[model samples]
Target: MNAQAPHATGRQALFANLLFWGMLLVGGGALAACMLVPAWLDYQAARQAAWAAHARNDALARRITAQQLQIAHHQRDPQYNERFIRQEFRIPTPGVQVVTVEADPTGIVAPADDAERAHRPAEPVFPAKALATARRSPLLAVFVLDQTRPAVMALAGALLTGALCLISGPRRS
Candidate 1:
């Protein structure tokens, strides 16, 4: 008599289960990876912003400290006056020659005009923006969600749907 092996159905069920489990594993892993991409991108942006803010704050603090020191110098130093300031800046100082030269293309030094340079207020320097971050790529922006709150939810839903279908699928004899 021609008949199928007694364990044929059992073998088929085992293979089917292995395949379903394998797909679940792979799909879940992929989803987790996808979810981490957004988080990683946000982390990099935050790090850059933090560094910029720290640098700006440090620059401003140093400027304030320098100004305070200057004030203290004027209050404490006995010789701190208009003459002293001018001498410090080498302005109108007798017996001292001031020379400014420009480098010529022919390697010759060309002295600037004989006129004394007038002291003007220094140019204002504004600190760089603290909130500036790297620009996002247009293609990447489409995939990066604002928030990845439910990282595992999608994997879970996919697993459940696949499992239900696999279990309830019609069986052939």
Candidate 2:
């Protein structure tokens, strides 16, 4: 009986360790879900806001570039400037007679023209230049833990060694 006691005790210890470890894993997983899920969601929201800001900034930059080009055009082209002044500003030239035409009120009265104009595409808030491909994430890669740290490496090595020992069990003489 004394000769077998060591092996019997070893088996019991191993069983207890396994049962305890299993329970710890289950509890740890639940705790992680409770804590980490909300944090991850918040992180996602922040990331989205950051991306939106970038989109707005890009759109503004493109708008600025277009405005600069327009200013350049206005400065360089006398024909464009004159046409823009005449058409856009409604400024009459010195002698050019302008004609005004209106739809005959006596003709068949049509319904409000809102429906026809509704089909015209609305202006986009963000320009196509500002749009980015929907990738996994526009932000930098994120990690829950720093894997490169010496402490982390040591911990991983220890866990691996312990797992190997657990799997092998007590060595037989």
User: Which one is best on lDDT?
Assistant: 1
Runs with alpha carbons beyond 4 Å of true place in candidate 1? 1-6, 84-164, 171-173
Which segments of model 2 are wrong by more than 4 Å? 1-14, 80-173
lDDT of 1 by residue, 86-136 (tens): 878867867777788866769875555312222232222221221122124
Error of 1 at 130 (Å): 19
Among all candidates shown, the one with the greatest TM-score: 1
Estimate the TM-score of every prediction.
0.49, 0.42
* lDDT of model number 1: 0.60
Q: What TM-score does structure 2 among the candidates reach?
A: 0.42
CA-lDDT, candidates in order: 0.60, 0.57
Model 1 poorest 10 in a row by lDDT: 125-134
